[model samples]
Target: MKTREYTFFGGIHPRSYKELSNKYPIEEYLPKSQVIIPLQQHIGAPCTPLVKVNDYVKVGQKIGEANGFVSAPVHSSVSGKVVAIEDRPSSSGKLVKSIVIESDGEFNYDDNIKPNEDINNLKPEEIRYIVREAGIVGMGGATFPTMVKLNPPSDKKIDIVILNGAECEPYLTADHRLMLEKPVDIVHGLLAIMKALGASKGYVGIEDNKQDAIKEIRKACKEYEGVEVAVLKTKYPQGSEKHIIKAITGREVPSGKIPAEIGVVVDNVGTAFAIAEAIKYGKPLIERVVTVTGEGIMTPKNLRVKIGTPFRELIEYCGGFKGTPGKVISGGPMMGIAQYSIDVPVIKGTSGILVLPEDMIALKNPKPCIKCARCVDACPMNLLPLFISAYSLKNDFDKCKEYHAVDCIECGSCSYVCPSKRPLVESIRLAKGEILRKGRK
Candidate 1:
């Protein structure tokens, strides 16, 4: 096994409260009553609903069709009748058009789901078509459609394909548990991705903290040529695609550009597993593994959950809240979206459900920046967050753009390390959104 540690510059080491759920094996979770599935789970254009209210749908049936090439279709996770198709609260903190289905307890599968052609024999175009039809997206929080990533534009040569197993975000271990239990699938998925992109090299980049996962993945990839395991240092935001690419391949993705521009393509290990399942079993992305954890949770666990399962069901399955919950995050504490209610359903990008106790929540009081430059030092992108935040708060977006605020990855390192407790990331996020909006105009 390779013990060498690889890393990128500038990242914080927060308390990775993984012990709350890491030890527990992934338990299968089935919703007994209902499921609320949002059509706009993936990034880019939202999907259009194909089934109407009162329509009976079978599990793995395509209920929502992709609106454009950049979008992904949505599948029904349970055999049930659509009770409602209206705007509902989503994990992204937006009221998205969602389809609510009441389970019939039958759990019937779609007839089209079956094993496909062998991976070695399938062509690159065939692989992309299967992935697109499967509705797979980046499971590590960035919900970009997987097929769009696999089909890069011509002239942008992709030499390496890296599978992100870092799971660097605190309190999230969905990817970690996946690596431990489904190493073979992950490897096969990587191989499939490499073949789809016609890339020469493939790597599974995992953090050193997950030793067992590393061992299992290394063992799985031992026979596969041009594939190896790259151990990453345990650091915050190390799982970021650009940072992981840098750590594994030493290729820096330029600002305002993607990994494809640097001759690399990165996909999360969970995405890889999904790809393997999609190509091998002809399965659509209807279910995923999610980490339901935090101090507020009574019995933290990693759960194999259906895509449309509500947060309330998962929380109740985990023994519900222990005490008064201060906050409920959809992904991880660092980069996850703070949810307004537990009524939201788990989407494609929902990696974890983090419920923070009242005591664990931080106060939002702002203080003057002491010019500490700690945020600057902690930023993995090596950008000056302090100046950008300062300008953003003042609504000076021109100044924010001058400082390259668009380059901010919104990893939350600035806000975490700020001793003054300033909302650095929050302001920078606003600036980035406005900057992009103006650029489009």
Candidate 2:
């Protein structure tokens, strides 16, 4: 079959640097002594602790209960005793309530974990229930509750589901590896999603650069009717949900509206794999594949990591730092969160752990915008980032909102293309936050 390439407007192609870790297959990394499970890994309300201090918890046991429909429950990654439940630092740079489990050395699985019936026998509500009970969320970094997405508002009509296989982020290759290694599972997951949403069509959108992954996914989808592979042009933020939807369906999601508003839904390939595991093996989301790579590390690898394993442990397993580590990001360099320490545990949204040395760190002083309009041409959202950022610096949030600052996807494209090295995305992000905050008042 001929692979047709799809692309969206206003995107910059930076150095992918994917080869640094794409060659390595995923290796399972188990925590040695303890695991710290944060209660609020998802985007919604934080989960409430179900186990107090000194309580014994088994592997895949629910340690945190979902507080609302938008939230996802948290499970223990290891069979251990709950030593403490206190506020702990999270990858989002906030102190969230967390449960600390001391490994008992014997990994015991929860009795509730057992395979379900065949996918053909399951109903739509059954699929949503399974996804919710499994505590699956958007594994592509959004971390929004997957169950909520499956159950869109009654007014919205979702006709298509897109599985994002485009690991377009620089230095991240977890989704790419998953597509090559578990293509069947990913396809099955996509089928399950389509069933849950009652969507008639399903498509797996992968980057053309990953020809191997595209071939694997296409082969897996051969038996499934209404499912096909759509190859995307290699570009930064091409894997973003909005961009992927635009590329695959040519549907534009209006500002302040979701993909569901346009009769479409998007899920990460990793999320689809999790759904397959949840329905087939009755497994909760306790582990995920994380790409541990960058120039500062002695060895780079893609590892299937437990949810609560510390970043430090993964780094140590990857041969530790090779040189002076300047920046440690919890995802890709383009949009990942920079960490002050490696003590943070791997959450569901952690697609990669990138370490950069001092030499690679570009320390350039902020210069005045040259008015080159490069940022305008590079913004995927087509918002004037230069004006939004400038107004934000002046504390004119109303002007920023008038410029549609909230529409900014925060993909860092404008910042990447800026000639003056201005923090375009950063300032726009600040303005967006302020705009939303004032709206609430």
Write the residue-wise lDDT of candidate 2 on 1-441 in tens digits: 865799999999899899999989889888999899999999899999999899999999998999988999999999989999999898999998899999897989999999987789999999999999999999999999999999999999899999998989999999999999999999999999999999999999999899999999999999989999998999888988899999999999988889999999999999999999999999999999999999998999999988989999999999999899999999999999999989999999999999999899999788999999999999888889899999999999999999999999899999989989998889999999999999999
Instruction: Provide the RMSD of all predictions against the true structure, rounded to 1 decimal.
Output: 1.0, 0.8
Error of 1 at 303 (Å): 0.3
Runs with alpha carbons beyond 4 Å of true place in candidate 2: none
lDDT of 2 at 323: 90
Against the true structure, candidate 2 reaches a TM-score of 0.99
Residue 57 CA displacement from its true place in model 1, Å: 0.8
Per-residue lDDT of candidate 1, residues 352-413 (tens digit): 99999999898888889999999999998889999999999999999999999999989999
Candidate 1: 10-residue stretch with minimal lDDT:
1-10
